[model samples]
Target chain A: MSRKRSRNIFIATCITPAIMLFALFMVVPTFEVFRMSLYNWGGLSGNKTFIGFNNFKVLWNDMRFIQSFQNSVLLIVLVAVLTIVVAIFFASVLTKEKVFATNFFRIVFYIPNILSVVIIAGIFSAVYNPRTGLLNSILGLLNLEQLQRQWLGNQDIVIYSLAGALVWQAIGYYMVMYMSGMASIPESYYEAASLEGAGKFKQFSAITLPLIWNNLRTTLTFYIISTINLSFLLVTAMTGGGPDGSTEVFLSYMYSQAYSNSTYGYGMAIGVVVFTFSFVLAAVVSRITKREVLEF
Target chain B: MKETKRINTDTLYKVFIYVALITLAITIIIPVAWVFMASIKENQEFYGNPWALPQGIHFENFREAFVEAGMGDYFLNSIIVTSLALVFLLVLALPAAYVLSRFEFVGSKFINGFIKAGLFINVSYITVPIFLMLLGWDQSLRQIFDSGFFLNNLSVLALIYAVTALPFTIFLLSSYFETLPSDFEEAANIDGAGYFRTMFSIMLPMAKPSIIIVILFNFLLFWNEYILALTLIPGDKKTLPVGLLNLLAADRAAVNYGPMYAGMVIVMLPTLILYIIVQKRLTQGMTVGGVKG
Candidate 1:
């Protein structure tokens, strides 16, 4: 056998199974989601009547769907901005060699990222429990009892509470990303900046910020994508989208529709919208961040 | 004179950094520590003084969590699903990544892109379709297995998890393989070693760091995955997260805060330990994968 033919055979043998599985599980089912969006297929029934774009029309008129989308968008913006700012701040501090107990602080901060969402929600639920929770207790200790209110139960504040929990959970991961990016920056820049008598904040703003712009962009993209797809566990345990559906992100809303309400077709329509939003947002961010590669 | 001035500034910077870090640590630790303390609090104490330290270590809560909540079975079920999924991911992704990274073949780029595209779609977006597919498969299994005993149908769920882990596995392994020098394979080829033997003996062993990262990340993901298990597994075969949710829901009208807290702690320990052990690798791997241009 020729060498080229044998290599082709090897590649074919290796790729076939994965290709088949991908088609069956991922590609086909994605198409199936699109197909189901066009039908009136409640989850349990064999009667799947064709109902063209009607599900999408229903979704457009659905106030809950609109609210869910708005909530998701708000979450994306809040989390993306807060996480980046916090991550960059910590990364800058930690990367300085003189920082004491840097390893200990890193591990402590990263613990939340490692935790399951269920556990995180459980802990935060205790912390924000209004009556006996830590936040209210602290408020009482500070003699601000009148200002203390139910954190998760208050409709106006539930989304902010959820966003706070998410930012706490995620800042560690993004900090690590920023730290890695900072590590890759040449030491000469810092030395030169110091030689030129650049103040700490000036060095950060003028030197480190632009140098790690790529990492910042990547982290922003990921944070946005993840927040948009925020799931049932966080929302359910923390607030159950509570105080009258105030905390319902798109994914949780879609989950409730499909599983809780058995509105499968409408849920599928929401799924399609989620897919488009994520894709377009990612594409735009990727394009915006596509700059000439920095060698250093 | 300049050196002394620089030293003073450096010392000041050190002081500032330590202050910031200590504050961040407190913010992170207090909530987790509160949860731990709350888990061991007696029912009365939990209600009366949720923030205070537990008066006594309530080992009974753990016992109750295991016995009343069926956490033992759920833990085993999770182990079975996560391990099987991890093994399947490694086996499938290893050779596929090797071939894609090393060989130039028709449709290879498209297949690589196909693997990556899975990561783009949120898992929830595909949940309805996956649930429908599994239901269909369960019906077929009943006809084939002929037992009407579908409780431990975690194998099918494991298959789905393997697919979910594939994108990361393939992406990481392929990149790692790309970094491997072709000299070793060439030397093995000169010695008449076949492709499989070369891969098993040379490439696989060399990719140990990548393999560990893949296993740890995939295990963490599959272990805590609640939505899929909730959808796929029958009521009796509940995994830990699902069981915790069920326990929470059982007394929906009343808050049985003790067992719910106990269940959360029990479910969290494995993941917490795994993270501590693999902290460095997990953080580094995520950064590289997430930030690479």
Candidate 2:
């Protein structure tokens, strides 16, 4: 055989399997989500009908979807703000300060990130249990029993409860991300700022912040995407959108509509919205947070 | 006089930092350590103070979790699925990543862009469609075989796990491959090594550090993955996380707490041990490509 022919054949052999599998599993199914949204396909019923955006029209009036939309937005904002502040604080401390046992704290903080969301759900369920929970019991011991309430059982507070778990799991991962960014900042920048009589807070805002602004901006997008995904997973495992659908996020509602309600069409419509929503949100966030990249 | 005030304020600042750091550390450590303590506590002890230590070692919860709650079988299933998925992922990803990054081939750029776009495709949205597609295949196969094949099959589940992981794995591996000096391949070619021979004996071995990172990350991913395992396997064959979810539900309904906590430990222990051993590498691996699912 010719040498060129042999090279072409080798390339084909190497990439064909991965491409085929990617198309079949990842590409086709993703396409199917969009296409199926335009049809009324009832799962397990062996009937699929073309509906032409009627599913989306129905979703417009879906009170449950709207509630889930609100819940998801609340979670996205709460988790992003809380996790970012706490994580950046801890990351700066561990990176800049000569704290004792810095390695121990870094390793311990990341423990929650390594475990399954299911395990986190289980842990928080124990922490949030009303009569026998760690949180309430601690309150009791501190003589602040009036502050204790049904952490997961109260409708007014359950969404916040989910937010807390998400923030807890997320802080370490983003902390480490920021720390890596912080670690890369040249120390000369900080020394110069200190020479100008900059306090710790001033130096952080002026020097440490802008140098890592690109990393911070990138994590803003991550915060949105991961918060959406994790809130669903945690809701699935912990609350199942429970105590009367109080904690239902986007994907959990989509999942219930798909499986529990058996309305595959409606579920796919929800999926399409979420997919577009995330992309748009990320783009808007990235646009708003855009800054001139700094070279150190 | 001014120096004394500055020293006092500096001391106060140091004290404040310590308090904040220790508070965050305790928040994380106490819950995990409490779970370990709770896993060994007797049933009666759980009714008392949540802060109280376990009175004595009670290993029976683990026995119940492993045997009665079926975590033992689920653990074995997880081992099989995770290992199989990793093997499939590396086999498929390494070659594709190798050729795509190193060689100039037709459609390579388009293929690269296509795979890069797959990074935005989260599994949560596509899961139901994949489930339906598998169900459709199973239905077609049932005509001839008188049974189903795609759904509830461990190998098929493993294949899906690997496939879903392709974008990230290939993206990471491709970047690593792009850094290699082409002179190694040039020298190998002059010595009469074919493409496969060079990749297998020369290029792949040099990629060992990255291959380890891929395995470690994906192992945790596949082991802890539950939604796909839950939906795809509607039957008895379940991964560790899905099984633990079931056990949690059942035990919660029955008000059985000890076995539930034990099940949590069972699901998390492997990942924890693995994390502790390779955490430095794992966190460092994050900055390369820096995407999370």
Candidate 3:
């Protein structure tokens, strides 16, 4: 065989398994998810009993599904905004030369991001535990008992409490991201802004925010996705979407229906909704955030 | 007078920034310390004083978590699944990345774009179908082997983990490969290196650092994975996160707070140690993927 012919064959040989595996696991199964969403099957077994979008229609009127969808969007917004704000604040500070132990602080901040969701949930639950939990105990110790309340059990505040945990876990990762973003900017921009008599706040809005706009937009997209999906693990761990379903999220709702409640078709329908909603949200956020890059 | 006022303002701003940063830092650090303290405390001590120092070392908590609460089993299960799955992912991604980056072929761009689209696929959205597919695998495996029930679950779990990881893996590594100079491949080809030999000897070795980064990304991913492991892997074969949940959920009846905390510690320690050790590389790998994506 010609060397070129053999080389082409070699490339094909090298490439086929990945394509096959990718198709089997991702492409084929994704198509399967959409197809199955139209049926009324219990699971893999028994008759599928085609219902043709009945599952989607039920999801439309499903209160639990609707509530969970709202909760997910709420989480996406809260986590995206809070994490970005906190991360930017810390990253901006750490990027400045005046900050002490930036390395130490950076590593410390990212620590929670590295830890398991289960562990973070454990810590959060302990803090939120009503009777002798840390938050209540600390409030009691400070003689501020009136401020203390059931953190996880109160339906009104439960999602917020869970969002707090998610933000806490996420800040470090986003901080590192913003840190990298800040690192790439020319230091001269900050110096010029300062020389122009722009104060700290003004310099941040002018120099820091504008330069980091690209990273911020990307981070916003990431935040939307993570807040929606990452909440699955955290919600499962901390509240299991509990205290009267206040914390129910798209994934947990789907999880319970598919596995716990054995309505795989309904669950798959919810999955399609979640998949569509988040992508649209991400696209909208990213588009709205798009701006002319301030090349330094 | 203006300069002095400016200096004072600068100091004030610094103080405000430091104070805000310090307070937030404490918020992150204290909870972890509390978990560690709780792990070593006696059950009553934990209930009585959540923040108190353990009266003694309580070396038994680790043992209790490992042996009694059976975190050891879950740890073993996670280690086996994550490591094997990472190996599987690398095996799939390396050559695919190599081909996509190097060879010109019809439909390659389409394939490459398809892989990129997979990045946006939230695996949870498709969990129902994926779960059913695993059930199908189980049925087929049982009928064929007439035994080895957990085999399909384990195999399917590994595949799922690898597949979920593929988009990022291929994207990152293909970019890495694209950045490489053609000199090495050209040199090997001129030296009469066969195709497989050239890829294995020259290209693969050169891609080592990128490969390591891919492995770290997938390793961290599979280690902390919860949802799939929760759905697919059954009772005793639960991965660490899922197993920790099971342990904590059952702890109400068990009332074994010390061991429960220890299990939490156990679940977190590997990734913690890993982050500390390869702190730079871990952050770089994850951020590279993040920033690039």
Clashes of each: 0, 0, 0
Clashing pairs in 3: none
TM-score of chain A for candidate 2? 0.98
Ranking of predictions according to DockQ: 2, 3, 1
Model 2 alpha-carbon drift over 4 Å, by segment: none
Candidate order, lDDT descending: 2, 3, 1
C-alpha DockQ for predicted model 2 = 0.87
Off by over 4 Å in 3: B148-152, B291-293
Query: Which DockQ value does candidate 3 get?
Result: 0.67
Candidate 2 lDDT over B249-289, as tens digits, reads 99999989999999999998999999999999988897887
lDDT of 2 by residue, A203-242 (tens): 9999889988999999988988888899999999999998
Give the CAPRI rating of model 2: high
For candidate 3, write residues B1-293 as lDDT tens digits.
99999899889888998898888889888888888888888877866766677898786888987887778888888888898898889888898899898887889889999989998877777665666676776678878887545432566688779978888889999989999999998898899998899888888999888888888767777898887788776556777888788778887557778888888888888888888888888877776677321
| lDDT of the candidates, in the order given | 0.80, 0.93, 0.83
> lDDT: which is higher, 2 or 3?
2
Please estimate how well model 2 matches the true structure, expressed as its whole-model Cα lDDT.
0.93
Model 3, position B256: C-alpha lDDT score = 75
Instruction: Note the DockQ of each predicted structure.
Output: 0.57, 0.87, 0.67
Strongest candidate by DockQ? 2
